[model samples]
Target: MSQMRLSLDQLTGTNRRAADILLGNDRGGYTVPSAKLYPFQWNWDSALVALGFSVFDSDRAWQEVESLLSAQWDNGMVPHIIFWKEEKSYFPGPEQWGTTDIAKTPPTSGITQPPVAATVIERLLAEDIDAHRDRAAKLLPKLDRWHQWFLDARDPDGRGVVAIMHPWESGRDNLPDWDRPLSFIDTTGVGTYHRRDTDIVNKDERPKNDDYDHYMALVRFGRDCNWNTDHIARNCPFWVAEPGMNAILRRAERDLINMATLLGQDDIAARATARLARLDAGFEQLWSETVGGYVTLDLRRDEHATGLTSGSWLAMFAGPVEPARATKMAATLTYWLSQVKHGVPSFDPNHELFDSIRYWRGPVWAMINWMIATGLIEHGETDLADRIRRDTQALIDQSDFREYFCPVTGRGGGGTDFSWTASMSLYWAA
Candidate 1:
């Protein structure tokens, strides 16, 4: 295994270089990883990327989110990605949504992407200096309203768990987990749409066509309707639960509750408490006791199903899985490790549909490794946690952040220099 300190030094160097632009006086807030792909504002990517910015300039870290937050709609929803002042051709720019009810004028979404802003805010506040703290102090009030919108608009049933109106809201963009549910939609009339992903990246490196079809269909549906929620909710695809995403929301709700409590927003704090209860129950419905892991639900499927994704470990983030269930989960993960050449395959390797080179089919991702390791440590599987940590570190040390790894050989597969993978090194080290 590579020395932790040496690995840390390598990580810190990348963090510092990225921070120079993120926190530097010379640049605004843009420091995205994909020059070709992003070339514009990405809502959730920049939110998490800013956490690394905090280690350098807490002020800049706060601004990164502020740039995103500034675009919040009157309904308090933060859109997934925002095009810049001049970059309109960024495929599916707000211009394409002129038919939808959302501000085709500015294209601000009346829905949220992910709830990471609050978590990032909470972390920054806990570690920031007076200047950093002051920025967060100012941001706290604004972020609170956005967080409240999540409870208000997305919660739908007043359950603490928030549902995503579109799969893009999860920001995973075409995970097989969403496919079966997304397939029920009729996309016959959306007209022809072009995909840019398969252009620069190989088709094998991208999501399945069915996934692409559903995604573009949904986006077109939203764009055609001007992003009207009541209209879309009635006719479009809305996912009731995604364990990995809802797991993050469960945690974000907790963070917002703490922030609200600190800011004297008792009503909001109480609402968050009640929401947590619902999400906790929501998780139980999604768990499979016999399989010993959590699976995603297709609110569209009308029945609970087995997904066997690395996402099963999301239960760990929600906190202790029931003891019997956690043990089963532990075994299920172990079973997957035994099947794949990589320590953990993205999907159960034995499954017929597993595809290591394709996005989210079956490949080891550094971030997923980070989450599962945390899950492992949480479930009295510390030995396995250490094993994951060592393996992940070894992978990064050899060549940082390849999109996916061969399921059976640990051969680096798919894209390179992915932002989240680099950040995984820091978060896992911490």
Candidate 2:
């Protein structure tokens, strides 16, 4: 470990305070992303939270992963929002997302977010195999089912690349990449409903009103389909193949295969290996030479988004790309770092739709930085990786653990005392 990592392990007043923030956000068995902006156990947020817990409390870390998977759907698809309890602090609650048609699981959003559970599980196990083995046994089969669900539902065409039926599924609720496909969605059926996100975070920091309209429009569509996976996949108006979701899923699938191998589950290992081959080939369809990074394909329209965002940078992190492709991506990342004080901006600053404060459009998220940094390190770009870690640490220290940061100004934006931001800070410090 580096000197900074040694210092982090020593536990200063700052570390104690960061831990307090995490504990403060802990609702009970699980932690919410935050108190006001997000009041439920979110899929991806819980995975990241597990990493932070592993830094100090390994048992709590494993429990966090266990709690997240406790709500897994029978089909293996882990719903995005697991409404552990009712809270009116956020919009599109359990009532809004009627998942009763899907299964008798906990109240959850019909659509799933990026699957990072396997990746988190692999990391925790790396810290202690003997301690996490039994838990890993329980999780591996469910994870295999989840991966199977993605293939069966999202990649029906056998393109190897899965499609996101809703923007929220991408975990980037309103990225410019979806603007084109979202426009085609009919919000006329969306009844009178209030948005609770704007109530807590700045309106400028959230998705635009039009984006929300389409978001709700898709929600209504899912509900109309009765949350039937086959029905929704066949008829959904919006279908975006996001690089971030693809990358995360790719990494998770790879990790799950490794875990499955250790557990003597050869069936899952074989299936995951086959899926990896398909994903490797399908990536060609999403490659955008003009953008200098992999871009998303609006599968519904059979069109590709030209805009480059943080999601595109995630391709390298997902897995190895062609050396030439990785070299170009490295150049692209270096170019963006030159444009802003921050190493990665959510969207390219040169793009007309880029917004410094608005969520997903153009903000540097700590979680994203941590992921991109890890990718950079794996690709042997240690300088950029170190820069990202340093920048993330400095920004969090200056901003007091806000949700995201302004890439150009290094100022915090969105909800404060955020769980993932705190989680990333602790990881970066270590």
Candidate 3:
């Protein structure tokens, strides 16, 4: 039997539809993840969306990133969600974050998301250095400050890896990797709060009520502390070192180091080089031979959280694992791929906790697949990488641009016309 592939016409249609999604979601300088569901410009979503815009609109791509950076806090931490303007649709709104006094301009959430901007900037710059050099030059120091903020605030111990105070920070909300650590958090004072997400999307497709309870409780805790890192680190109940987030930061540091060197920012390059070394060594603590892949560390408990999720595969994308470990991860990934028609379920499909329709438990995210495939290619797993790319394209073909797809059914779930989904599809189809 011959393998299926997207025809030239289909590829062109995909690109056009993806561009339309970005255009539709565009709100002047930045793009929202989705119109009604997300509304606000998210930290990581904008970074990824910028990459998507770079495909056809270079100016818009740079604008997307610049808008996101404009919300950077005085302390250098870029808030996860920048509320350029208030929208009633989103819960845990700017008021909940209480960052008006602390955050810049339009206000933002107190927490930061996975730092993917540096990596995205590097890619954009590589595509057209002359076109983006000046923009990259101006953004370079701000990006450096953001990374340094992580080192100083999240990794006060200089552990090479940073700890995420909330699951949202890892950008893998409701991931099973956080189950144990989140369980330790008490939601006694969470109070009554309505979640706009469940109201807009299917309740089953979103994080459970209990998850929201814990989420808001943590939000309140941060609000109480004025979103101070030292205070949160000292008292927050949910502190975990996520492999996926660390891998992202590690990869971004590598990219940032290159960007700094290219832009003649030697001091920033040297600092990032040293930080990358620490991150490379830090992976040792995250690896679990039992799981046969990297796992999240419960920083509060000072123990490894046992679970094999898609995040475990991000180490491949981050690219510092030993050859033997990378080989083992490839084999393990192959085994996981075999369990479902679609590739790279967020949670191992075989796991009892796996929920195909749920937000993150077992959904197949295009962004995850793209990152994993890129890592595979870097690690010389070209065949596996190609397989993932094909799977990703198949997912997009089967379902339009949605937040995520069910690995078992290839049906879209969560918010529709998702910016990052469309962004990744554009890249995959290209």
| lDDT by candidate, in order shown | 0.63, 0.83, 0.87
TM-score of each: 0.84, 0.96, 0.96
Which pairs clash (backbone N, Cα, C closer than 3 Å) in model 1?
Answer: 100-225, 100-226, 101-226, 102-226, 160-275, 341-408
- In TM-score terms, candidate 3 sits at 0.96
Candidate 2 has an lDDT of 0.83
RMSD of 1: 3.9
lDDT of 3 by residue, 129-188 (tens): 987899999999999999989888999888778999988999999998888888888899
TM-score of model 1 vs. true structure: 0.84
lDDT of 2 by residue, 1-430 (tens): 1212222346666565666678899887799998888999999999988777677777887888888888888788898999888788899998878886564656888889999889889988876687778889888888888888998899988987999999999998888898888878778877778999888877988888888889888888888778777887789998778789999889888898888888788988998888878877787788876776789998877788988889887887888877888888888788888888875789988889888879888888888888888888888889888988888877877777898999889889988899988887776643
Clashing pairs in 3: none
User: Candidate 2: lDDT of 219?
Assistant: 88
